[model samples]
Target: MKKIKTNVLRLLDQQHINYETREYEYDDNHLSGEHIVHQVDLEADEIYKTLVLHDHHEYLVCCIPVMEEIDLKKLAKASGHKSVEMLHQKDLLSLTGYMRGGCSPIGMKKKFPTYFQEDILLLDRVAISAGKRGLQVILKPQDLIQYVNGQCVDVIR
Candidate 1:
């Protein structure tokens, strides 16, 4: 299979960051995290999904394991927002330059404060969207956090 390149992959290369990519089969109509993990063959804990949320003033990004859910109250406190809600699906592409299932923390059109689930520190490697669907980038969790200027916080439920 041919390697696929995306904004996320290119940015990692430009920064000389070490990472690997996994391509999987996907259907546009069924873009669930469960399907992604099944295709990539990684434990749910090692695969993360990016979420974009806002408190009306600014957008915040969170990367949590596929099997987990974000605790909005905790995220609000961590991000210093009184409340936060998911960014609308319609605004995701224009704001982040990626679709719902393909949003990666890195290489967004504009940098936003990013957070990763604290437990990610326990994993040696993690897989995140490659800024596109059906592909993932595997790298050290710390490296990913550092690149996105993200901190690990208790954002998962």
Candidate 2:
């Protein structure tokens, strides 16, 4: 198979980050992270899904394990927001320049305050969207955190 290229990959390259890419089959109905984990044959917690949230005035980005859900209150506290809500699906593309199911924290149109679930710190490596569906980038969790300037906090329930 031909190697795939994506904005996320390019950004990692520019930063000289070491990473590996995984390509899998995907369709509109099968974009869920569970499906990606099945296709990639990795532990569910090893893969994370990117989410966008906001506190009306600003957007916050989160990368959490696919199987876990964000604890809004915890997220708010970690992000120093009075409260936060998921960014509407309609606004996802316009705000991040990436579609739902393919939003990666590393190469957004603009960087928001990015956070990773503290669980990620337990993993040696983690996988995240490569700025597109059907692909993922696996890298050291610390490298990813540093490259995106992301904080690891207990934001998941």
Candidate 3:
């Protein structure tokens, strides 16, 4: 079997950002939250999940702690969009260069506006997708924001 290359790590290397990748066997049936919690052995509150949304015209990426749900209205308001909805699986893959369960906050096909729930910044280090299932990278939340040029907002319900 061939190993898949993770664009997340590639981008981090290109930017000279220090990150460490941890991998395990991923079960396709597991929800992202479950995978982060069980496979990665991280608290659900400290693991952030990336969600792709489209406001009909433009795409946006929202990162929030796994235990929280996204507030579409808040996200729309923060992005200055009239409305926001979750992107379809196909659109998500096209936009982020990742599949539904594998989307990472880093290494998007194009740099779209990104926003994160402000509370995530309170963590010294958090785990996020490493561009694939069964893999995650532990890094400071601030470092991720700086690297992605993401705006911090209270976009989680």
Where does model 3 exceed 4 Å of error?
1-5
Which lDDT tens digits does candidate 3 get at residues 27-136?
77767576567776667877888999998888889999887899999999999999899998877776788987779989888898999899877888877889987788
lDDT of 1 at 13: 96
TM-scores of the candidates in the order shown: 0.97, 0.96, 0.91
- Give the root-mean-square deviation of each candidate in angstroms: 1.0, 0.9, 2.0
Model 2 over residues 78-154: C-alpha lDDT tens digits? Answer: 99999999999999999999998888998899989999999899998999999997889999999999998999999
Residue pairs in candidate 3 whose N, alpha carbon or C atoms collide under 3 angstroms: none
The order of the candidates by lDDT, greatest first, is: 1, 2, 3
What lDDT does the true structure give each of the candidates? 0.92, 0.92, 0.84
Worst 10 residues of 3 by lDDT: 32-41
Residue 65, candidate 1: alpha-carbon lDDT = 93
| RMSD, candidate 1, Å | 1.0
Off by over 4 Å in 1: none
Tens digit per residue, CA lDDT, model 1, 66-113: 888999999999999999999999999999999988889999999999
TM-score of 1: 0.97
Model 1 residue 50 distance off true place after TM-score fit, in angstroms? 0.3
